[model samples]
Structures are given as C-alpha cells and as structure tokens.
Target: MKHYLLAVQIDETVPEPEDELREQLARTAKVSDEIKAAGAWVFAGGLLPSHASTVVRPGNGTTTMTDGPFAETKEQLGGFWVIQCEDLDEALAWADRCALACARPIEVRPFDDVV
Candidate 1:
C-alpha cells in the first residue's frame, strides 16, 4: 500500500462563522471515522492557524528560526490526513469526501518510498 497525504487548504482571509465551523468539524470527524473503519487511516489532525506556525531554515553554518508559516499566502495548510491506499484513485476518492466535509480544497500527494 502507498501512503498518501490529504492536505486541507484553508483561506485565512475568509472567516468561518462559529456555527459553520462547528458543522464543518462534525462532518470532518465523520469522514475520519469512516477512514478509520476502512483500515486506511494512519493518522489525521487539525492545526492552528498559520500564524501559530514556526519556520526553520538552514544557512551556511547554522539554522535560523522564524515565526509564522514558511509561505505567505491566504490559502494555507490547515490540516491533513495520512492514509494507506492501493492507488491514486482510492486516495482521490477519500480526498473528494474530505473536501466536501470541510468545504475546502484537498491536496492529495503520495509519500516517496524509502531507499
């Protein structure tokens, strides 16, 4: 099985109302439960806003740490799910469900094999 990452993208510029946010979370949780039941779930988690992130960069001889996300974009990675699937099609099916549940875009990518 190949491991794929379903990354949830959130547009920070648009604010989600409390009620809508709650409903989205509920729907997302249901999808997560389904993934787990299918024995495809490896891990899943939601993240704080991009502002809460920290970036570390390597320099000539040292690493520099910076507050906030590495990229400056309205659309940021809000959460993700790592799951094992038979192929890209299976992963895409899950991504479709996830995107609808969260009312956001889902970026599906497979993990590279270890050498």
Candidate 2:
C-alpha cells in the first residue's frame, strides 16, 4: 500500500460560527473513525489558524523565520490526514468522504516511494 495525504483546504476569510464548527467537527470525527475501521488510517489532525504557524526559510548561510504561513492566501491548509491506500482511486474515494464531512476542499497527493 502507498501513503497519501488528504489536505483540507479552508478559507480563513469566512468565519465559521461556533455551533456550525462543532457540527463539522463531529462529522469529521465520524469519517476519521470510519477510516480507522477500514484499516486505512495512519494519522489525522486539525490545525490552528494560519496565524499560529511559523515559517522558516533558508537564506545565504542562515535561516529566517516568519510568523505565519508560507503563502499569503485566504485559503490555506487547515488540516490533513495521512492514510495507506491501495492506489490513487482508493485515496480519492476517501478524499470524497473527507471533503463532505468537513465541508471543505480536499487535496489528495501520494507520498514519494523513494526514500
């Protein structure tokens, strides 16, 4: 099996109400449980807002750190799930469910096999 990353894309500009967010989290948790039951779950988690992120960049001989995401976009990676799948098709299937549960876009990408 190959590993895939299902990235949740969220638009930060639009604020989610507390009640709605609670419902969405409940749905997402259900999907995560399903993935675990299917033996496909490797790991999954939600992330703090982009403002809580720190970006580190390499310079000439040192590194510089910034206090936000690498990109300045309203849509950012909100969370992710790493799962083992038979192929791209299977991974996409999971992404479908994940997107529905979270009511957000899901970006599915496979991990490089070569170490």
Candidate 3:
C-alpha cells in the first residue's frame, strides 16, 4: 500500500456557525472512525491558523526569523491526514469524505516510494 497525504484547505478568517461547527466535528469523527476501521488511517489532525506560524531561514551561517507563514494567500492548509491506501482512487475517496466533512477543499498527493 502507498501512503497519501490528504490536505484540508480552509479560509482562516471565516468563522463557522456554532451549530455547523458541531456538525462538522461530528462528521469528521465519523469519517475518522471509518478510516480506522478500513485500516487506512495513519494520522490525522487539525491545525492552528497560519498567523501562528514562524519562519526561520539560514543565510551565510546566520539564521533569520520571521513571523507568520511563508505565504499570504486566501486559502491556507488548515489540517491534514496521512493514510495508507492501495491507489490514488482510494485516496481520492478519502479526500472526498474529508472535503464534505470539513466543507472545504482537500488535496490528495502520494508520497514517493523508495525502497
């Protein structure tokens, strides 16, 4: 089985309704349970807003630090899931569930296989 990364993209500034958020959380829990039951789940989680990021770069043996994420964009990676699947199609199915649960976009990518 190959490992795929399922990334969830969300608008950091948008505040969802309390009821809607609750619904989303419930849906996500259900999806997580499904993934686990399928033995595809490796890891999954949500993340803090991009504003909480810190960037560090090294130049000429010196390290420079910056506040906030590397890029300022309308859509940021809000969370992700690492899952082992048979193929891209299976991964896409999982991504679809994630998108529906979170009401956001999900990007699915496979990790390179090296033995």
Candidate 2 C-alpha lDDT tens digits along 3-90 = 9999999999999999999999999999999999999999998999999999999999999998998998879999999999999999
Quality of model 1 by C-alpha lDDT = 0.96
For each candidate in turn, the TM-score is: 0.97, 0.97, 0.92
Q: Across residues 1-115, which tens digit of lDDT does each residue of candidate 3 receive?
A: 9999999888877887999989988998899999999999999988888988889989999999999988889899889999999999999999999889878899999998975
Given candidate 2, what's the lDDT at residue 98?
A: 95
Residue 86 lDDT, candidate 3, scale 0-100: 93
Q: How many backbone clashes does candidate 3 have?
A: 0
Per-model RMSD to reference: 0.8, 0.7, 1.4
Model 1: per-residue lDDT, tens digit, 1-115? Answer: 9999999999988989999999999999999999999999999999999999999999999999999999888899999999999999999999999999999999999999985
Q: Which candidate, 1 or 3, would have the higher TM-score against the true structure?
A: 1
- Return model 1's CA RMSD, one decimal: 0.8
**Per-candidate local distance difference test:** 0.96, 0.96, 0.92
Model 1 clash tally, residue pairs: 0
Error of 2 at 115 (Å): 2.3
Better of 2 and 3 by lDDT: 2
